[model samples]
Each structure stands twice: as structure tokens, then as C-alpha cells.
Target: MSRKLSGILNSMHEKNMDALIAVKPENIRYLTGFNPSSFSLLLLKDEPVLFTSKLDIEDASQSSKVPVEELKSLKDIKELLKGKIGIESSMTVETYKKLSNNFKANITDLIEVSRMVKSPDEIKNIKKALEIAEKSFEDVEFSGTENEAAAKLEYNMMVRGSSKPSFETIVASGERSSLPHGTPQVTEIESPVVIDWGAVYNGYASDTTRTIIETDKQEEIFNIVLEANKKAVSAIKPGVKTSEIDKAARDVIEEYGYGEGYIHSTGHGVGLEIHEMPSLSQKDNTTLEKGMIVTIEPGIYLEGEFGVRVEDMVQITNRGNVLNKLSHKLTF
Candidate 1:
């Protein structure tokens, strides 16, 4: 068995779970090498079996680290599942009813918890994704419409070997930058462009945000956000609470009289998915551990004015290591 599968099986054993039914694609991919493009189920026990629809059977057979089988129906899966079945927290209600009937079904996060730390291969993939994204950003000339800029950036990433843009590329410029999750519009590019983009390679992802500023006030706010980012990154270390890292950033922005404007969680874990566990928020108390990769992003939005944000991926060790090589300040 693969190391990941072994580790998960051990976790299940500890919980006295006879088997685990993983319905989430990422969770299934975490245990087996195959990433299901269609509906798939992974029954993990002493000998794990990956069941895929006929559409994916050929691919699953070739790529999976575990045994692969054609899924005839949920009834077949239900029969194989014996006593104390552990199910993922994100399982659909319909699936739960179909496959977990009469079994001791319990929702669990064992797979996600196992994925919190990065393996050496996973780290390498993430670093390569970052490289592709940063290189693409450098090649783009930020003078076109917001939509054009976003399309160009994504195109460059794919040419540089990203599987795809990790998420919707945000190219919010001028006043629109105030919207944290603003979508790129067809309007002409303006000063203070807030570009939050990422690249995915080998299923691992890299997320970052850089604002191109052109005014003294924008620079002032930019510096404050940068300091907050730095302080938060510095606060990351094994044994520290995720909330403390968040406070390190939020406190800096609050000290600058922009607490209310600092509207989101400080950051979140990133891996197979752009957003994962260990969210750096006031309520999350997950402890930092070596080998985990997360983002340290803190931004301030002035309602009628523009916004500025600087984000970088960080790896936890004895101290937090910033992964992006791009400069914090980007000017047009």
C-alpha cells in the first residue's frame, strides 16, 4: 500500500472504523494516485478498492495506486462496506442514504487531516506552480482591459505548464479593487490593480495576490498591508495557534485604524485545493506544524476608494518560509 493509504488506514483503525468511503474527488485522489474526472468512490480498508464509472475505468486502472473496479451501483458498494463505516464530511445526502443504509455511518475528516502536511513531492509540485504563475505575471503587460489582462495571465500560465489557473483570475482595478472577490470587468485597466491569481501543477496549487499601485495613498495603505503580511508570516511556527498568526496580521491593520476594513480571514491552507484547512481566522485554533503550506494574505478595503492586498504562500518549519520570489510592490 502507498504511504498515504497506510497512514489513513491506521487513522481509521484508531477510530475503530472498519472502512472509509471517500466520495470527495480530492479525498479519493489523496489516497489513490488517480484523480477522478467523473463520479467515483474509494472504499478504503485492509485492501483499498477504487470504483469508477465505466467512463473512468480505463483511466483509473492505469493511474490508480490501488486496485480499480467498475462501479455497477451503489448497492454493490453498500454490500462491501461492513460495520462502523467512516464517511467524509462533504458526502452528499443522497449518496449517504444510498450507500450507508444499515451501516454505522460516521462523518469524519480523516482524509483532509492527513493532507494538511506536504510531502516532498507535493512541495515540489507547489513550488513549480508558483514558478509558473510568477513567470507568467512577469511576461504580461498590464495595460489592456481587465478581462484581457486576466485572459493573458491564464494563457501564459498554461504555456508555462500549469494544468490550469487554480481559481478564477481576479483582475480588479481602480475602485473595483475594493471588492475582495471582484471579477474582472471589460473596463480599461486602471491604477491600483488588485490581481489575485494562482496556478496548478500536478494537482497542487499556488495562490498569491499583488496590487499594482500608482498613488501616495495607495502606497501608504500598501505598506501597512505588507507589514501585516510580514508579521503574520513571521508568527508562523510549529506549535503556534493559527489564530495567533491571524492576530499578528489583523492587529497590525487594526492598529492602523482599518480593523473593520480588514474583512476576511488572514489566510488558509493550500494544496490539492486552493482553500483548505487551518484557516487563519479568529475562531480557528489549529496548531501550525512543520511541512504544512498556507497563505498569509491580509488586505484592507476602503469602501468608496481602492484596495490593496499582498499575498504570498508560506511553508511552516521552525519558522515560516515565504515561497513567492516576486517583489511585494508592483507598479504600472
Candidate 2:
């Protein structure tokens, strides 16, 4: 086993736990290095093992660092448990109930906590994914309807080596941009378009959002968003709380009278998945640490009018280091 895997196993043993059952696909990948398409399970202990469906048997056998077994039924898994069992908090309540029948079960975030800090190889993969995503954006023609722009952007990312778009490409244009999570539509592009997109490379993900502004009002909002993003990036340092980072960006937006318009959290940790731990939100108290990769995205949505968002990936070192080199300002 790798040192990281050994560390996680040692931690489990320290807690007087026999084994940890991980169901989340990202968690499974973190420990085993295999990305499962269907249902999968990871039992972490001294001799870790993975249970995957038949569909993934070939892929799991090839990519998984741990031993793989065909998952037959819950009854079979129940037989594998020996002592006190641990489960991820993100596990569904139904699964928890089913798995807790015979063994003493406790909820734990062992895998997620470990994933907060990225390894050197993981960081390199994320950086490469970001490069592909940024390059793909430059090739997208933003003059057409929102859906057309999104389709073109996704195609560009695919052709440039992305396995897929990290998420549904957000191509909100005109007044629709005011909705923070607005979906692309058939309507023609307008003065301001909020393009939030990402790319996946070798299963690692990158997330970024940039707004193109056409008029002074749009530029005004864009400037405020940029200011928030800058402050948030500057605020990242070891020991700083994730919520504090959110406030740093929020404060900038509020100072310019767009606080209410800034709806979502500052950002989130990104790795094998688009959304991960150490959420940069008011409710999250995760402390910043070295080797943590996160996004510093800030936005202002002037409901029913227009919106602007600026985002960039930042890998937390001794200090915050922006991973993306693309210019924030984009005009057409």
C-alpha cells in the first residue's frame, strides 16, 4: 500500500475500528485509484479490498490499486464484516440501515478528511485539467445562443483531451445570468454572458467561471466580482477557516452594495470530483492547509438584469497560489 493508504488505515485502527466502508465514488477513487461507473464499495483496513459490479470488473481490475471482488449482494458484504464497522457520512440513510444490521456501525469522514490535502501527483493532474479547460474556452465562439455556446465549449474540451465537461456548462446570458446556477437556453447572447465551465483530465476536474461584459453597467458588476475574487484569493493561508475566506469575498461584494446579490459560497475543494470537502461557505469551518486546491470564485447577480462572475483555481501552498494563468477579463 502507498504511504497515504497506510496512513488512512492506521487512522482507522487508531479509532478502534475494524474497517471503513466507502460508497462514494470519489472516495473509492481516492483510496483505490479506480473510478467506477456503477455501484462500488471499498473496505479499508490492513488488507483493503474493493467490491464492484460486473460492469466495472475489467476496469477495476486494471486500475484499482487494491484487490477487487465482484459485488454479489448485501448479504455477502454483511458476511465480510468482522467487527465494528465505519461508514461515510455521505452514505445514504437506506444503505446505512442495511449495513448496520449485525455490526456496530459509526459514521466517519476518514476518507474525505484525508482528501483535503492533495499529493504532488494529484496537483499535477488538476493543473493539467485546468490548462485543457482554459484552452478549450478560448476556442468557443460566444456570439450565438447560450445553448450553442455551451455545446461548442463542451465539444472543444472533448477534442482537446477532456474526458468530459466537469459539469453542465453554465452559459447563462443576458438577464438569465442573474440566476447563479442558471442553465443554458436557446435565447440569443446578450450584453453579459456568464460562462462557467470545467474539464476533466485523467478523472481530475477543474472549475472556472468568467463573464464577458459589453457595457459600462456590466463592466461595473464585473469589477466588483473581480475585487471579491482577488480578496478571497489573498485571504487564503494555512490555519485560516474556510468560512473566513467566504466572508473575505463577501465583504468586498457587500462593500459595493452587491452582498445580497452574491448568493453562493466563495468556492470549494476540487479534485477527482468537481465538488469536494473544505467548502468555502459560511457554514463550513474547515481550516486551510498546504496542498489544498480550491477555487476563489465571486459573483454578483443583479436579479433580472445581468450578472458577473470571476473564478480561478488556487492551490494553497505556504500562501495562496493561483493555478490558472488565463486573464480574468474577456471582452467580445
Candidate 3:
């Protein structure tokens, strides 16, 4: 059995869980190398088994590290499950009902917890993903409409071996930049373009944001955001609370009197999923650990005016190690 599977089994045993029914796609892929195209379930126990749909069974068998079986129905597998069964929190209520009968079902994050601290291979994949994203950004021409620019960026990433964009590419400019999660529009591109983008490589993901500044006010705001990003990145290290890193950035923005404008958390983990565990926010108290990769993104949005944001990926080790090769100060 793989070390990851062994660790999860040990954790389940410690929790008095007899078996774990993993339905989340990422969890299944993490445990077994198979990325299911359709719904799949991994029953984790002494000898783990992957139950995949008929459509994916052949592929799953070829890719999965564990034994693969065709899933006929929930009834067929329900009989196999016994004792205290562990289910993912993301399991739908309907699905839970289908399997919880005659057994004690408890929501568990055993797989996700294991995924938090990346292995060396995982880190390498993330770095490659970041490289693809940054290189794509460098090749993009920020002319034409905002949507066109976004399309060009995405195309660049795909051609550069990215399976796909990690998330929707944001190319908001001018007043639209004031919207933190703004979508690229068809209107002509404007100054102070706020581009937030990422790319995926071999299932791992990378996230970054760079705002192209034009005027003095934009530069002023950009510098403040950059400072906040630096402070946040500097605070990343093993044993530090995620919230403290958030404060490190929040303080800089608040001191600059953009507290209200600085919406959203400091950052989040980046891996197979764009957003993962240990969110850099006030409410989350997760302590940073070595081998964890996170993003340090700070922004200030002025209503009806503009916004500035600087984002970079950071790896937590003895200290913070930034993984992005792209320059923080990007220009057209």
C-alpha cells in the first residue's frame, strides 16, 4: 500500500472508523491515481478498493494504484460497508442517506488533512503549474477587449501543456478592477488592468494575480498592496498561525487607510484544488507546516474608481519560499 493510503488507514483506525467511503473526486484521485470522469467512490480499509462508474472503469483500472471495480448502484456497495463508516463532508445529503442505513456514518477530513502537507512530487507539480501560468502571462498582449485578452492568456496556457486554466481568468480593468472577483468583459481594455489567473499541470494548480498600473494613483495603491503581499509572504513559516499571516497583510493595508477597501482573506492553499485547506483568514487558526504551498494575495478596491492587487505563490518551509518566477512588478 502507498504511504498516503497507509496514513489515512491509520488515522481511520485511530478514530475507530472501520472504513471510509470517499466520494469526493479529489480524494479519490489522491488515494488512487485515477481522475474519474464520472462519479466514483473509494472504500478505504485494510485493502482499499475503487468503485468507478462503467464509463470510467477501464480508465480507472489503467490509472488507479488500487483495485478497481465497476459500480452498479449504491445498493451493491452498501452491503460491502460495515461498522463505523467515514464519509466526506462534501457528500450530498441524498447520497449520505443512501449509504448511512444500518451503519454509523461520520464526516471525516482524513484525506484532506493528509493532502495539506504536500510531498516533494506534489510540490514539483505545483511549481510546473506556476511556471506555465507565468510564462503564459508574459506572452499575452493586453490589447483588444478584456475578454479577448483573457482568451489569449488561456490559449497560451493550454498550448504550453497546462491541462486547463486552474480557474476562470480575471481580466478586469479600469473601474471594473474595483470588483475583486470581476469577470472579463467584451469592452475595450483600459488602464490599470487587474489580471488574476492560474494554470493546472498534472492535476496540481497555481494561482497568481498582477495588476498593470498606468497612473500615479494606481501606482500608489499598487505599492501599498505590494507591501501587504510582502509582509504576508514574510510571515509564512512552520508553526505560525494562518491568521497571523493574514494580519501581517491586513495591518499594512489598514494602516494605509484601505482597511475597508481590502476585502477578502489574505490567501489560500494551492494544490490539486485551486482553493485548499488552511485559509489565510482571521477565523482560521490552522498553523502553517512545512511542505505547504499557499498564495499571498493583497488588494485594495476603491468603489467607482479602481483597485490594485499583487499576488504570488509561497511555499512554507523553515521560512517562506516564493515559487513564482514571474516578476511582481509586471508591465505591458
How accurate locally, in lDDT, is each candidate? Answer: 0.94, 0.91, 0.92
Q: Candidate 1: which stretches are off by over 4 Å? A: none
For candidate 1, write residues 1-332 as lDDT tens digits.
88888999999899999999998998888789899999999999998899999999999999999999999999998888778999988999999999867787989989998899989999999999999999999998899899999999999999999999999999999999999999999999998999999999999899999999999999999999999999999898999999999999999999999999988999999999999997999999999999999999999999989999999999998999999999999887
Model 1 RMSD, rounded to 1 decimal:
0.7
User: What TM-score should be assigned to candidate 3?
Assistant: 0.98
> Clashing residue pairs in candidate 1, if any?
none
How far out, in Å, is residue 76 in model 2? 1.0
Clashing residue pairs for model 3: none
For candidate 2, write residues 1-332 as lDDT tens digits: 97779989889889999989999999898888899899899988789999999999999999999999999887788888889889999999887777778888888988889998999999999999999999988888898789998999999889989999999999998889888889999999987889999999888999999998889888888888898899999999999999999999999999988888878999999998899888999999999999999999899888879889999999999889999888999887
How does residue 62 of candidate 3 score in lDDT?
93
Q: Which 10-residue window in model 2 sums to the lowest lDDT?
A: 93-102
Model 1 weakest 10-residue run by lDDT: 99-108
Instruction: Tally clashing residue pairs in candidate 1.
Output: 0
- Give the CA lDDT, 0 to 100, for residue 135 in model 2: 92
TM-score of each: 0.99, 0.97, 0.98
